[model samples]
Target: MKREIENKSKKKVIIKRQDECLRPSIPQFSVFEIIRATNGKLIAGSDDLSVSGVSTDTRTLSRGNLFIAIRGKNFDGHNFINQAIVKGAQAIIVESDFRFDASQGASRINKDNLSLKDCASVSFIRTDDAIGALCNLAAFHRRRFKIPVVGITGSCGKTTTKEMVADVLSAKFNVLKNKGTFNNSIGVSHTLLGLNKEVDIALVEMGTSNFGEIKRLAEIVAPSIGIITNVGYSHLEFFKTIDSICNEKYDLVKNLKHPFIAILNGDDMRLRKKAKTSKDLNLFTFGLKKTCDFTATNIECARGVLEFSLNKKHRFKINVLGRQNAYNVLAAISCGVIFGLNYKDIKNKLSAFIMPSTRISLKKIRGYHVIDDTYNSNPLSLEYAIQTLSEFDTKGKKVFVMGDMLELGKRSVMLHREIAKKIIKSGIDTLITVGPLSHHAADAIKTKKRSNLKVYSCGCTLEARGILLNLLRDDDLVLVKGSRGMRMEEIIEDL
Candidate 1:
């Protein structure tokens, strides 16, 4: 199950990961228990009831429990409040200020006094902030269980690294991991709620587009181990600058108070410099640099597998693409090593790591090569995808199918142009840009060379798909990438 919880408060928390985290003894709350927990301060009304599982949606609310009616940007949960009651929700938790003025023509229309069966049993609790209250409850549940957690955050590779770390650690422990990008407030909260008593380890990937998000996630996960993949330009629209991005991403690291194990990319000088302040914690560094604790030397990318020797371990192969992923794999390996896994065991498990969807996924269609890294993109990410595409073995031309990199803010044009220059230098034979912002990149490519290299600038995904289908031959290698908003993965399906 996927869910996220965020704390808007900026307070930093310091804590150690405990061994007894995944105890299966579920926190069973009765209808009366919830009513009593929120009695004096939670709501003005005295109605109290209990149920199973907290829900923000009326459609999914279960019987005999609390239904949190939260107001969102697009939809209001209040509209479905009655539906939740009919669906078996015993109590409702609405925002405290939610008012109904009978004279305003809003209250009498819906008959606000509708009661449930067996006379005034359904309870309604009001809170100033439903989301915050929910987060507090999740944190309370976490402390109650005492689960060991490893929280990971970065501008990129958060999901991939989380999966790798979980997989590597799971080879030994019964691990519970946060699914997908469920690193936000709601996602993190839901992940914690899913935790039963049997889980031995919790691996959560914390992602943030703005400040204070990771900080909130850290409070919920309270990881003893923290991993920061190399930070890059992601969510620039929300952050406005790279420095701000770095500071926001480091929010999780600064909050840890345990014998906190920090795994950092030694290659990223910025990240390395930041690691200095974290010196009080037990630090493990990973990169290709000779000075690092875990370093990869003699890296080679052949076919779809990448072979690299780490700390002189001769035989290590990763199923993912890109030399840049040496950084990602090194982080995962460092985590395994810190957890007391032998070098040989870590090396053997490296081969089991698969690229998550839309991240350098290689496929063969009608003898042509298609590299689908279309999950999302930035100027830096596109450059790495180009490098990976350049290494693919193919009998025919190399094709690049790209979409606009969203959230770049003011630097979108310059960044797009750089992508164009890199593609030209990488010897791409064809370029199909899916959105208008990508015109800058395509124009840059057209300025330098004209050796039968086709640059087609399309207005949208449908047009790009048409161009690619007509232009690609049976033996060409095509790499598709774009921001999440562009939905570039659709093109991959068409191919």
Candidate 2:
């Protein structure tokens, strides 16, 4: 009788498995949740629906993902909606009044004899604006998690500082950080949507070229901790002035509610002033100065490593080749301190932290020392790079290869001339420049009539590369830097 009962139980379990195989798994975000988050109108599909993920690009859209069609200056996402659906997109969020042409058959979509039921099977939600709706949805998704989100913004070192902060936090938490330069509205939204129960923290790096950009991003992220690396003369074409840049960058900290900490660069005069006057902010400061809450002293740079003492006691070393990184390290240390991390653990983590590529990356090429700072450039960053090159001990000539710093607007000439003065004063042996604005720097050097200085202004990267190849000597220390548009890294490749 017992053996008969066991056989009956096994049969019942097998029948339940067969029934489960007949049904499919549901997606993560229900159709109602999408409508609520984006305030979108459901054009088709059942109300009880869900998606496995959210995607902006049809090329990478996975099966059961919600495709958001975002329109940009050069490309329209509306044109790719059909393609997204064909690629197994579970649903699509688009602008209102978007027309669906069944004639254009997508990969999985059957064009001929398609009906409302076919459209309903692949859900469609329409909003007033697709990008705005994406931001709304990301904001809603972010609220689902209560983990700490750290937002970093500045004219320079935002990316590096973001990476450092994430590395420090990863010592105790599973960290999710903005990849590459994904700090804009669309990028931040995608990053926020990636947050799940597994992630312990999110380090978001925000970048902007115009006013009110940071404010919009801040509203979406609502960071628990805000960090401003430093306010510098970057994107002056839109910001117009350093004070304007400061106001724009400060929006991140300004948007945070009470019970949040503002990590500020105490070395920056504007931020220092703001820290002094800003009321009701839980502020923590970091810099090389003694006044900062987290300070670094006894700094040393040798063979592409930066060693410094934190708070005049704890010693730390980072394997990056820039003295300006000291400020970035100090900022990260402030964060670790705020989070109750011990000094020893913070030092251990920082020691293993490596800098992102193309930002002051030191390399050796064919018996020449190359400092590739070609990722991006601004007045402040250019000055720092120039100083770093000057400080390096070199056997052969010290060469400075530069390109124009774009988006400076009316200040382009003045800023380049200012950089020219620094180059001349730095005692660099050779200065090779490219681009039209960089001519201002070469001209500034020519006006000085320094017989010891060799200045060459090339019209393009090819010409610059030829000049560098002919001039480079064994053991020469060369620093290549420029704006992203200039593609300064190509010069290094050519050499």
Candidate 3:
């Protein structure tokens, strides 16, 4: 009787296994697909083999993953290939000329005297350039999903605009956005590769400092829609002039294939000029002016919340503080409208969208109102932040803790002095400058000899923190901003 019962249970198990085998499964990439995408030589690995996922960092590599060794400034990922293999990376992509050096522990012996290759079923792929190959693979993956990709680029407000656009679009579709401010080549590639059949839209932010960067990113993104927030003096050290910056940023629009939408900031003179000449593209303009295709009017800001109407018909509100953010919202709304999202849905999504941290986030520390904009800064963003700070309703004195706006090259001193002039005009009662370039600002203040203002110049963030700790008052509203290298957020942390 017991044998008869065991036979019945085995039959049931076999029937269930057969049912699962008959079910259709999602098609995953084969080894040949990776070879085709990367144009790489299969050093070791079967053509029919499949990997679970792709990764660059060995620390996070899981079983059946494909690892691409990226060579960065401080670390060479080739050094970690052995660890990745031990952690169960099924395949590895390395430079074509990379060699397995015995001194670097590339070889291991097993109890049966088998080599590393004989002991495990790992595969090796060789590419002429590992990073380029990774990007190619990502582009290939992106091609499989036929979703709308919105590529955003500009010197400032790219991240904020990307977030707002993603939020508004999420109301109608499943959205995949660039995480944080990862807007560089590696970042954009990784973001594009994250797409799958589930995603309905991709919002990518492209950031650049020199020529060809935006073009390369755009080629990989192949966006159906492009957004240029506004050109500014962000990376002048590398670009040298505003014209060069504009040319680099406009690459996104230039790369967009026909039957695409190009959103321009009508208020930005450079973009406005470009829109005039771009007759071949489907152009949409958004700004405060009524002439814009999508216009925001009747603007109001109270208690750090912004309320505005689009063409005097669609009303929207955002909690982020600053009039500059209103332009970003307008850009997002224009994108939503282009995607056929109703104004009501766009407004509802944006109204609940929270601002990204460290981009003009307002907070109360101890008892002081602190405007933290220290993620990164250039002349244009600094001016907007200072202007916003000046307009805030404050019974107490307004103070600014500023650091060097880096990458200005030869124009650093001139720009710093210009900022000092703006600071003086903004009615700031107290100013603390950090970093070497900011010394020019302090000198400009001294040259002006304002009796009502107090100025302090510090060599580094630590010194700035000490001075701010002693100088800050409970009633003061302080604004802190600087380039990423200056780490201006330290003062805010110390306070």
Candidate 4:
């Protein structure tokens, strides 16, 4: 999986991950087809032209790539048209108001210059919105296939459930899962655009930080089945209440047409209530609760594995440390069962499923057991991490090095401080805070007056790293985590 992150210098930094494939499994398309999908007017080059694939950044543009001039809060792709042409873009999709200049591979665009030889080398599409054109074209191409598409979403466990569902389906079919947390409208479009003949199923993970994103993604995915892991305190900056989060995630189920399957987390009473009114769906629920269609029992974690029994009959052991993963596993298993896979096959497939290193990983470093979950953080996941720490059998004191959890909106500080209650019960000996919000957690813990616990607050990750380096002992167990901006990995990377 490859994702683009912009640094302080305004340059795009591409990080390539090992678990997922970043290379294109894309099919080729003709200029006329793209124009038809995008409702674009051809301005230059022959309508018969073809492009190998699509790209947004000139830094990675290949010779036959169709470049879309997408505008963002910080940068505009239109400003790099000349650079894209020099990098060998076969076509360009620009806004309707974009006027061509001589530097755009040929002389300034005009009716008389439509047949210019220089401009003929590159095709052009003028659309009202470039980003909308990209999604339109992708949805058009997606209409070409009639395979089973599974759309997965939730506040937490979306990626894990998506990966596990993909792994289970891959045992019997060729599956293409969206890479990483690329669950935005743009990322979902890219996944649909990559569909080809060899794929039997498309597993798309949808994420939303605001309203309407899930509905838009569902409009593109047209899923045969949808999985919602759980709606919790995620993206609370935009979605202020749990009820709003519930409604936002339910868009996946509501947008689906008749006769579609809706899989939900049964333990979430909110989802269960939603499922009651959704009588039109072929509903399935999974969790640790007995009433669920698929439920796990005898949950246990030892070393680096999680063991659970489904429906009190079939047993499964997966490579993971978090007992909270039982919910994610049950969701994946429910999907496999709905897809007509036998319990034997599902068991074999799931037993071999190794969650991506990005989710969470337990490692040994210099005689210390380190749990790294620095990908991103939210209240529910943080609570689960603390529970895992509390249950762990450590030879030395258990320590939690947490940074601020972002996107909580007005309740940001309260939520941080709220997590202090979980920390007190976790039996962890030390807490190191790394941001202003996390400072609230430190203050709350101090108010409790826990004599056995020690706390430290720092303004930055570097200061936290220095504190940890001096505070840790030989056999201590440590967990490091934060939201994307806090860079919490600094505490464990070298220590």
lDDT of 3 at 65: 82
Weakest 10 consecutive residues of candidate 2 by summed lDDT: 12-21
Pairs that collide in candidate 4 are none
Residues 250-339, candidate 1: write the lDDT tens digits: 777787746566778778888777778766766677888988887889999987888888777555788988888888888888777666
Q: In candidate 2, how many clashes are counted? A: 1
Q: Relative to the unseen true structure, what is the Cα RMSD of model 3?
A: 11.2
Residue 24, model 3: Cα distance from true site in angstroms: 12
Off by over 4 Å in 3: 1-28, 101-120
Query: 145-182, model 4: which lDDT tens digit per residue?
Result: 76778899998889989989988877787898898888
> On residues 268-349, what C-alpha lDDT tens digit does candidate 2 reach at each position?
8898787667776777778888877778899999878899988778889899887899999988887776665677888889
Per-residue alpha-carbon lDDT of model 3 for 292-389, expressed as tens digits?
Answer: 87788888876588999878887888998888898899999878777666778988898898889889989999878999999999998999999889
Which one wins by lDDT: 3 or 4?
4
> Where does candidate 3 clash, by residue pair?
none
TM-score of each: 0.88, 0.91, 0.91, 0.91
